[model samples]
Target: MGMIRFALAMAVLLSHLPLTNVKFIGGGLAVQAFFVVSGFYMALVLNGKYTDRGLFYTNRLLRIYPAYFVMMAIAAVFLFGFKASGTATLGMFEQAYTNPVTAIILGFEHILLVGQDILFWMKIEPDGDLVFDLANAPPAEDKPWAWQALLVPQSWSLSIELMFYAVAPFLARLNWRWLVALAAASIALRLSGYWLSIDLGLWQARFFPTALFLFIFGMLAHKALPLAMRLPAWTGWAATAAALTLIIFLPLAGLPDGAVRWITYVAIAAAAPFAFHVTRNLTADRWIGELSYPLYLTHLPFIGVVLTYEPPMPVLCAIAGSIALAILLFVLVDRPVDRWRQARAAGKAGPASTMAAATP
Candidate 1:
């Protein structure tokens, strides 16, 4: 999850850059990587059965929201309170920051886990004529809400994730043929969804399939990777490494662009070795992975505050502050809620039960 979260934060950051004009790499692909990574981790984490859906979602909710809301509040404070600069001009920097009604609304989206589903505040670039009277200008000429540029942009991916979560258990319980069919159908649907998103003027449509595809891949891996997990560490690492090398060498050109979306399917397939190697080492190294959800929900607004008004402060300062905020969130918000949920889950366990991990 931490890996997913970090990738998510990276995705949002990369997504907003001018790099879309670049040919070889695009931020959108970063988010797609995140979806696959997310799918992989979810399958790994939720492989076990549970009798309580309520507890399951509750734990998930608790694990995600506390740090999320805290970051929102901090973002609100900084957006409002910080000086625009030593320069003398009153602007949205302070006014927007102080009132923070917009920030609050955006924050609410994450708290409600509905950030990605918001279709009303469409990206201004794509909807300029419909949304506003701006005319005779290309979509490129318009600037959307600054909020859209942050990690908030990928909240839509989270919604896709929730949909996957809804179906994951059913996927988990299926046999190989069933899983294989599910994957084939889902791959078809996923591509159709992306094409529809591109053609239907829905950016999020392009978004959901990325996550959905990754998730299906993750389910497949969960089914297949156990054999490798059963191998010795050296063998596991070697196999994992070989898989990764194959990924770099895979003929995955036109991956997102080509109808051969299955190329990434194979790349992630080959990359399974690296995935295995990392996951084995990850359970014990729980800090960032554990803090990932909080970091995901919180990091952007915190960044917004730092970069708000395009401050004259050095970029390093903003980076430093953001790191500090991430640490603080893990300490003050994420850890406590995870602890609370684990305790509650423990107390509610049945007589024969040993334990349940309230995974984020």
Candidate 2:
């Protein structure tokens, strides 16, 4: 599971590189794949560890926000100190700041991370009006896409993750049949975009409602955990290998883009439990898995910096620098916070501590 998570994060990094002709599992698919993983983990924790929703919510906040703020600060330094005024984030910030109301709203979204996903569905007019625009297309000359205002633009996915966290406890309580029905409905909504004249690229990819099915698929994978545990141990390794192969080599298999995506999704949903079952007890594997979150959060800033400075082999430099920063963040930030999170979950700290560790 850790290896797969790491690979998925790398896939996102590679996909974002300036190389125009390269093809692999892209940032979009990798993010959706992560939703599946998040669903499985959330289901696991809600069922096994959390008896109290408040603890669950607080612990999740602890897990996300600390590292997030660190990256946000880094982005700010680049935006102001380095005079990255030409960047979309800086431009968006400057334009939005001209209107006091827009500045306040966007500022809160940046700080709180609750409504960042809505930025994808909106645009900022030249006059600073934040208008709803479902098309999510590039705006007229001088108008900027609303998402450009995001300092950490990719944090939109974090907003989606937060939404899932908000609903996951109740979703975990549903019977398998009910869960299946809800997932089916979500999938129907996702696939209905073509006929409904919605832009599938933005809506299906970014919209919480349509993306719910991917997470549900992961929850369904969790429901299959018992079956996974009962299977021969070799099955776990085999499942992990198969999933890796699909993610890495599927593009070379000559399939249609859409078909490749569904195949990868289904493959990940089916394989995740087995992968976790195999890797759950390995200390090194868990540590590697821990890097994925910080890596995902920190990579874009490094990429932006390297691309701005035009270092030799900027892509490779960005990837290496991001990984190094992820290691530092994992060690300096995540490790200590995780100890506290674990203690709180284990009821070691106080009455607020009511749950147990769900994963290492």
Candidate 3:
């Protein structure tokens, strides 16, 4: 699972390179992969884990926040301190708007990864002339979509994932019949906006519900399957083929961007987690796992540095620098956090294990 995640991260990283737009764009498939795998794992773990929701949420909170804050701080310094002048002239600069209060709101939204309601204004440039809209202009008399607010573009998915979490507990308590109902609701959400718009929390698009359905499918699969049984060989192959085909051919067909996204998520949910589980058995001795977290944590800053400066620094140096940053982050941050999570989990697991052993 972690390797799949690493691969996805690599895909995203590769996609961000200035020159590799087309080839790298395929990396977006990785998130769908993650969602599928997560859906399976969550189904497997949610019931057991929810016995201690506070602890489950806490561990997740801890895992996500540290690296995120570090990255945000780096972005802040790069955007504010280094590019202060450029930002003042070209971007939003004043402390009055995106200040401490903003950060606090964004910080919570960061955990969920959606800041959709973070209000702001937009003004289309005219005649190539720069125009700044007054801060927080009231919506035009009848216009509901005057401006779009985005602190981080990636966050839209995160918000939907958080919505899933809120609903997960109810789903967890549901009998199979209710899961069928929920699945229907998800589909309805997806199709409701086909002619208009899907009201997927805040996205106002079909992607969220489409992806959510894949996730729900994963949950259903886990609940339906025997622990010893792999997904039927033919079912698995068909899904993998379908997903890959859509991903490769849909754009060429002029299908909406969201169509490929849905296919990718379905493939991911249905296959990736199981594949990762198999891979772990085959490559349990690999070295990448130890460095993966740190690598994930620090790679963005490394890319940002290169991109912010001499961006096209020959592919070799860029790769080297990224690897070096990953290695360093592991040595410094990842190892420590890993040890912390392990020790904490071990501490909690200890008494139970000992009691079981003693009882037996």
Candidate 4:
């Protein structure tokens, strides 16, 4: 499971780099795959480790925000101080903060990470008013997209993740039938947009409601954990291997991009419980898995810096630098915070074991 998580993070990192004609599961698929993984883990914890919803929320926040703020601070320095340009622009900042009300609202979103995802559905007018732009067009000479003000632009996914965390406990309590019904409804909504010619580009990927099905797939996977546990341990290893192979090689199989994506999602959802069953007890694997989140959060800044400097082997440099920074963050920030989070959970739920430490 850790290896799978790391591979998905790497897929996202590589996708963001300015590589040409590379074939792999893209950042979009990787993100959706991550949602599946998040769903599985949230189900794992919500069902077992968290008896108190308040404790679950706070532990989840601790898991996310510490490393996030550290990365956000680094991103702020690059964007505002050094004036790096990829994730955001100075013009976008000026437009965002031009009106006091807009500034306050955008500022709150940036700090709280609650509304950043909806920014994809809006654009900033020249007068600093935000208006709905379902098309999600690119920023023009006068109008800037509201999401452009995000210092860590990709943190939009975190907004989605936070929303999931908000309702996960309740969702985890549902019977498998109810869970399936909800997932079916969400998937129906996603398909209905395309069937009805609704042009749901803005909503399809970023919207929480449409994306809920992927997470529910994961929840369903957790419900299958007993089956996985009853299987031979080697089955877990086989499942992990098969899933990774599919992720890495499916693009070369000459399928439509959409088909490949759904295939990957189904493979991941099927493999997750088995993978987690095998990897949950391995200390080394868990450590590797811990790097995935910080790696995801911090990669964009390093990519921005590397691309700006135009170093030799820029892609390699970006990947190496991102991994190095991720390790530092894991060691310096995430580990300690995780200890506190785990301690809090232990206080509430008895002892905190590796199986109970599942995170997306």
**Candidate 1 lDDT, 2-57, residue by residue in tens:** 34335435444433432132222234444455556555555555554244667656
Clashes of each: 6, 1, 2, 0
For candidate 3, the lDDT comes to: 0.48
lDDT tens digits, residue span 161-274, model 3: 555665665566677777767778877866665465323323233145555665677677666445324555555445445544544444566656677566556555555434
Query: Residue by residue across 25-68, what tens digits does model 4's lDDT show?
Result: 88888999999999999998887777889999998899888998
TM-score of 2: 0.93
Using all chains and alpha carbons, the TM-scores for the candidates as numbered come to: 0.68, 0.93, 0.66, 0.95
The candidate, 2 or 4, that scores higher on lDDT is 4
The prediction achieving the highest lDDT against the true structure is 4
Candidate 1 has which clashing residue pairs, if any?
2-289, 79-97, 80-97, 80-98, 116-156, 240-273
Q: Could you tell me the C-alpha RMSD of candidate 3 in Å?
A: 7.5
Task: Report how far residue 226 has shifted in candidate 2, in Å.
Answer: 1.7
Q: What C-alpha lDDT does candidate 2 achieve relative to the native structure?
A: 0.82
lDDT of 2 at 254: 90
Summarize candidate 2's per-residue lDDT along 1-360 as a digit string, tens digits: 888898888888777776444535888899999999999898888876667789889999999999898888887887778744223656667777788888888889989998898888888888787988776676765688787777778889999999999999999999989989999999898888988655679878888999998899999999888898899989999998998887778888898989988998899999999999888877788888899999888787787777777888776787898899999999999889998888777762333222224363
Candidate maximizing TM-score: 4
